[model samples]
Target: MSFIIDDTDIPEDDVILFSILYSCVTVVFAMAVLSKFLTNEFRFGFRSALSLAVLFLGEPLCQFFVKGPIGVVCFAVGCLLVYSILPASHLPVGNKAVLITGCDSGFGNALVAKLDSIGMQVFAGCLDKDGPGAVSLRHSCSDRVHLLQLDVTKDEDIQAAVSIVQAHVGSEGLWGLVSNAGVCYIGELEMISEWITRKVMDINLFGAIKVTKSFLPLMRPAKGRIIIVSSVLGRISFEGYGIYGISKHGLIAYADTLRQEMRKWDIKVSLIEPTGYATENTSDSSMRLKREEIWDTMDEQTKATYGREYLDEIYNNLLGIFKMLPDDLTPVIRAMRSGLLSKRPRERYPCGAGADFVTYIFGLLPIWISDKVTMSMSAMPKTAKPRIQMIQ
Candidate 1:
């Protein structure tokens, strides 16, 4: 029943031993958590890990290691615990404003509604301001949501948007810029022509770059956030998505460079890399049409070599992958929200079912091994016979 401990009853050696054991256990667990979360989730590479090691262990080595363990444990645990909680506690929305591109549909359209509901001023940049998605947002959202016609690939459109956004925001500046406009192209590498590749790149990679550059002036003063909606394909490429994967991969490179450069201004850049999801572009009918268009563009020799059935098999393989995808966009929406509002936003968010596991395994594995694994999982089914035959 006594609340006090008797120092006389316990030996001094036992107290030292107990403290050492406790510190050892705490340090091991802390290291594991930091390695898993920092390397995989935050995408912090080797340099950051080395710097963190110095930070966590520096004090522990000082003062002949006495009182060092307690200090290290307290610092690591306290800082990480607070860091975990900070992301969930969003910043005050207040009168802050955000502009989301590709608002005509999908993630951009959904994010517009979500941010607007939370009281942030929203500029919904639609490819067509009169389009159904834009009209729906106009009718559904509050007076604070403004709709602008923003086609990212067009220099004129991007410039006009800058002018419009600047006129409205004045000196307060834009709080966030979501470069969500993108197009997908799924076909064999040979089937995808230079023209097709260029078209996809125009919207997915170059468009995003141009839009971000134009808005940097507006965002620089506010030290705003930049969220790029990339794809899981950015980390790992598949057999049929050559063009799409290339564009997304380019985005990964651009975001990395931009993140480091923006640090001086305190602007944060984040990427949302989602796996397969049921969206308008990924619908069965739309994909079918795209397949047909690609097929039509091929020459006689090309068609004969790859064959109709072989091409059909590619489409079938994509549908099989889609079957496993979640139709719910909630995960992606939450990631976008975190990227915009979190106190400590992740560098890259792998969103969707098994996205983290999939990206990690395939992204880090040797290319040969990853290719074999990818083929085993979702490669195109073989045709009955080889398509090559004597032309004569």
Candidate 2:
């Protein structure tokens, strides 16, 4: 068949197809960024739906009035171009080697799965050798998941991890480190033993430092990312979380300073502050056990002084609040992946609904007001003054 050049044969269907494809691509890009920033699924879903509805209704109207598909294409291209130029946390890299601590459960476990789904070679460090999380990760990811027994608080464990990575580097190398191992201690700071306080700091803050220091050499001049999994409590303190909050607060400072220190070597340091996650880490069983242990250890005199009823009420309320909070750990995994793979990763990523909201509100408040708010929220009943003995 002989084909004749015919400009009139260009169908309207082609234009429509092009417009739809362009619009969809633009929408995906927009949503990706929104997902990164907003993090709340309900809010993101609603806003996304609203925006698309407007675009669908408004685009046709514009096309009708403007008299061409050209107008729609032009507008779509313009918006897409603007989005392309805007800074986004999503990464382009694929198939990286990643190591994550505390992968026995919770956010670390979730993140390991997510990274594996994205085709990364994941090295999951768990506190338990035969834990359900380790078994699950191995089952889902098969050989792609490497399980290592690790306790971040222990120097020997840290060293062993370093050795493993070094051996792997001889063949395949790591791209990032996710410092997700940490413990929480709830109670009056004064009530907690000095040894327990030290242990909390050792695990939460020092452990991160040790792991980073040990593994950083593996990255060398090429540079790798370090993601510190902190909490919203890091930025703002709450009642009964005095020790836990203090440890995380120290982490914020540590991450910030480390970011600056690592800049010279092109190594990036990022922080993920997630709100309460629905995991055994924050479950009623764990919290109740800890509270009971603390209560049981108290001397009769100490119990009499504080009153058992008051302590019980305070601990119960704290755990209840944590249980009520919804968990969306996807944002934390997203942040971790972005930090590892993005060309320009953000210094800090706040995850979960409450965390993002609280962070924004905290930013808006004055320093004095914020301090007062924290103090008021964490207020406890005053202790009775020591009895004075009169000399006769």
Candidate 3:
């Protein structure tokens, strides 16, 4: 085949290079299309895969063969193809009902506004009814948005929420349940006591499970979705983030198990594993003070082994991660929106650019390499060897 574009400024060698690179890109894109389809059981239809493949291959192929500028035409065609097959979530979802926990702030609050803007009935679950986020949502959203007090850790609060949601959803049934309420704590495992461990796990993991269980009856009727907000730490663990990571890790397992069991009712379960974003959980002041408090609780033997200097360095490193977190929470909100509104939802939605790589790719590497790479992010304190001269 003649692979050259006529009347082009492109050189022959450059064409060869572009062709090779474009081929690789095309293959990868095709693989993604195949993988997404097989895993989702062709949820979007064959056209969805075709549309995506065309979007990836068309533009590049046009540039290589037809004309470099023809790539623009391919992009336009690809967009239209995708639009035709895209689900209803792209537009307003009216009449459908969704309940979001932790609407007091962060992704949950933003999602309430987004869904409300689209004319969907939103139930905003807040731990603090009078808190700033709930107040803002109540004022901004339409009458369809209802604010309900919910504490995921408490059975009474969860049961109360269930009743409120049932009353609201009624015959229509709840279309979505978003488990976004959770807490984060930073410290080594040794420093974090059994109480702290239970506290973190209870809220982050058990709390999500509690909310989901309460709403399952409603969701089962509508074949609705359950979207859990997890962290990238759920996919990759680090040194100081032990407690937080454990909770998220447990959440992932629960979500995965629920996804299978719920298949009988066609209820969708999706985990939004997002890169850290700027939220109350990632607040600089709260985390720094938290580290100090956790350090004070450590036993003398543990403190001596790790030393205060190590804690200081770790505290500083934690600050860096929080600072680097993106201010926007849109990616996570969008993922939940997709799960709630789409015909076929992915099992796992990793938010942000390189998330899939870390979640899927990096996880496949050798354990030693992965461990070294994670630990190398910051140094761990070294313990001194015990003297043998006394025994001799």
Candidate 4:
């Protein structure tokens, strides 16, 4: 027997089903285009989900707020907003000018190479003229890479960079700013020196803001983008990373606020949060251990009271985990490019497998639950006292 349906007798359920299907397809299509430009899956996943949620719920909610054409208008506007914010597939490419800070190593170096490889003009900011990053980029990309001596924490460097951009690209030419330069100091919260804490905040948080503020005026007219390189630590805290975590936490707030404030100007503010990546910093485990040695010496009494055996075990555990984690910087480079080039760029991107999963789980949990989990996972039991104490 053949099934037949009268076109005029279609059920309301069918209509709703069709609408929902169409809506979902549209959202997914938009997200796919966005994912290409976004290098970090974490950022793309969170932002796309949020926008889709709003779009899916918006029209139905409008039905309650208003009736007929007015409600329809509101729904249409909401849809447009969502689409407008999604990254576009056909974003302009080639010869685009970009300024990246902290190109001395790691993400900055990787970004510089990636952008230059794709034929974009890269202006890299290094902490020193003779820094290894500048030397390497200059050796490889040569003319495509312009290494500027920049200390993000210094006002002189910020002003100089602004002038350099205006001169190189003029007002209409510069396209993006990648604020990737930052520092990290890991240790017990109470044991970390006040000087170190302030220094970490200065570079990771304040430096990013300084660079953005200095260049924002130039970007204001052209709707240029700013990509802030944060860390997974910003979203989730861990043992021995208190100061670094504090810096990242500040960035989370800064990036969010900047995103809202810049909406009117059409200047997009995106943040890249990457977990442990193989960079010069992570590779130099010996240097980190040496720093710990100095701290250990300085706080010998505290170390003795706390029990050296326990501290040693904690240190070893941290080192082993760091060694096991992947050190690839490619993901960070991808995320940075996506933030700069995506048609509907996300506000935040989390890089690395561990970073993605951990941030997602932590973000979903209640504050209290997350805190308990972190504490439990990071805690170490006390150990017996050292057999002998050395006086330095």
Candidate 5:
């Protein structure tokens, strides 16, 4: 049937065409502006930029040019092309294998299930094989998912994992290695002791390196992908995220170098940065309690030097992340899969709501300006509480 129209009104075809054209142009323009920032943040080069442009604008572009019933057909075809252009690794599900660390909870746990569902052989490296998440994951997948006890920092655990993965893949070599284990605790430079500092670095920085190194040989022949899970804080650092920021900064640097070096070996490397997505104990209340715990550890003199109010302020600021972050981590999982499977994956994927803002805009900003802006939101957690009585 034809698109019949009243004499008083514009033709329906014209209206439809205008709407589709306007929508496509508007969305593409907005995404173009976003590209300026995302490109810097994630190093989203030409390929990624083009892929995303098509993915975001294809349907409207298709619908506008192809009329009526034909438009619907064209829209589907455009969407398929857009999806196909994006970096996505495709292999027989059960044929490929990936080992992911920190599979006990959060992104790691979620990704393990996602990969397993699609048919990949998943070696889920949980900190505790007997943990609730591991047990749950095991129950869900009887085969193709193996849960191994892993502590990224420990030598023995790494060796055992290498042995396990080698046994499964044989001459084929492992297809992917994901460094997803990390920890975060908030405190000032001096407030945290050398021991705590070392622990954080050992797990978040050194541990990932250890895992990657151990599995490199297996991946070499297989020409696999190394996926590093980093935080937005890797680029943007501030008060409460001091040590964690240091570790992430180091991690990103390490991953960047690895990506460049691995290129010659035909092995891919990608970094996935997510904003304040909920991890097992990363809730606002849990972090507040953690801050309280850290406060309790301070020596009396130290406590007196930095009052409880100061720590409270820091924790309160930390909670600001919860407001911006989404609980669901599907974007992160998709990124992981793309890096793992896609023949030409991105060097970095910044997923989640504020990931780009934190990495690109905030990271690129002048420190003084950022400091001023952040401080206005809440006073920098003071080294010492003001002595109001002295003023009186």
Candidate 6:
């Protein structure tokens, strides 16, 4: 009648063999789970789920087979060892050339150094080749890194870049094309002028498309990789950043379609979607200035529609959020490197903390649930109560 009526009739050797068999099965499961966790952009949810699985399923299975606490410890140690030695699928980097746009600053500029350090031939496309960001890249990177004065928004620049790249690579062909050039603009949809919207779309959406298309011929010969840097907002729209999100959203659509179409040619396409980071484009001070500029430029009626206090409140809350953002661009740079060099590259790299969770919710949840979840996020429009009628 007790819980201890166990395996008294079973042979000791038989029991030991069963334990070893279960341990092997568990090791395979653990390896698969750990590999998915790392390669799938480090999803925090996956880590949580892994913990739950181990607690509920793994514990019982281990107890039934191995019959001791020591078995559990051994299992954990095995998982750790497996993760430590997980093999990365990386292509040969020697003599491979990669072209990255938006090298004037931020992720693009940082990635130039990263690729150059890895001994990959880097073609850094800067909007202003003589600017400070470009100059720093020139000084920091080795001779393998070449600087090209290229603007994504300009057809002339795109054609010139093609010619320059063709001349250098010759018959070898370009190995990678990273469409990292983009502009950030955050404003209410109504408050945003037509020109401003076009500017954002031109740089963030059309520019990326043109750059990718222009490089496809070269990429086809080498069966190169295409990595597009988008934002988490591209997947889930946020208040006060409609235009910027739209542009990114467009890139998401383009990249997804291009991936399927390029399968025949063996070209790989990937998307890097990151959350807020302390880059020049997302600097708190610069954002504040940009918000203030939008406010200053609004006409009387438009201003009346949204009071000055409303704009300030939105930006103030956002500034607080921005201040807490991680300044390190390493995770994003690593994603780009993997996208370019990995033999089996991931289709989407969601970089940043909580990014995968948020994207998962928005992508799967219902509209109402997503709205509620979005509200829970910090510095959103729902939190900012706007007064439409200004007092005299």
Q: Write the per-residue lDDT of candidate 5 for residues 125-212, one digit (tens) a residue.
A: 9999998989999998859999999999999999999998999999999989999998888877767656778888999999999999
Tens digits of per-residue lDDT for model 4, 1-392: 53333334556676466456546645665565457446443344544676767656775665444434455566667666765655555367655789999998888888888888877888899998687778888898858788898999999988998898888887575789988888766557655666767777889889998998888877876687889888888888876778888888888899899999999988889999998866666555753664565365445565654555656665666666667767666767777888888776778777776565788888899989997888776634334333455667
> In terms of TM-score, which candidate is stronger, 3 or 5?
3
Better of 4 and 5 by lDDT: 5
Tell me how far the alpha carbon of residue 292 in candidate 5 is from the true structure, in angstroms, after superposition.
5.3
Per-residue alpha-carbon lDDT of candidate 1 for residues 100-131, written as tens digits (9 for 90 to 100): 99998888999999998889999999999999
The global C-alpha lDDT for each of the candidates, from Candidate 1 onward, is 0.80, 0.73, 0.77, 0.74, 0.77, 0.81
Q: Give the clashing pairs for model 5.
A: 88-342, 89-341, 89-342, 93-119
Question: Taking the tens digit of each residue's C-alpha lDDT, what string does model 3 give over 1-392?
Answer: 67575745777786676556555645555565556456442344345656666866676667656654355455555555565454333333767899999888889899999998878998898999889888898888899999988988999989988898888778778988999998877767876767778888888999998888878888877778889988889978887788999899999999999999998998889999988789877787777777777777777666766677767776676777678879888777777888887776778888875676688877788988888888887334434221223222
User: How many Å off is the CA of 45 in candidate 3?
Assistant: 20
Residue pairs with clashing backbones, model 6: none
User: Tens digits of per-residue lDDT for model 2 on 265-342?
Assistant: 888899999877777777888878877766776665566566666677666666766777667777677667777777
**Over 4 Å off in model 1, which ranges?**
1-88, 384-386, 389-392
TM-score, structure 5 vs. true: 0.74
How many angstroms is residue 255 displaced in model 2 relative to the true structure, after the best TM-score fit? 0.7
Candidate ordering by TM-score (highest first): 6, 1, 3, 2, 5, 4
For model 1, what is the C-alpha lDDT against the true structure? 0.80
Q: Give the best candidate by TM-score.
A: 6
Clashing pairs in 4: 37-338, 39-334, 39-335, 86-344, 87-343, 87-344, 88-343, 278-327
List TM-scores for all candidates, in order.
0.79, 0.75, 0.76, 0.74, 0.74, 0.83
Per-model clash counts, in order, read 0, 0, 0, 8, 4, 0
Tell me each candidate's RMSD, in Å, in order: 7.5, 8.4, 8.6, 7.0, 8.7, 5.2
Q: Candidate 6 on 48-155: residue-level lDDT in tens?
A: 465446645764555565554455565566455544433246777978999999999899999999899889999999999999999998888899998999999999
The worst-scoring run of ten residues by lDDT in candidate 3 lies at 383-392
Question: What would you estimate as the lDDT of candidate 3?
Answer: 0.77
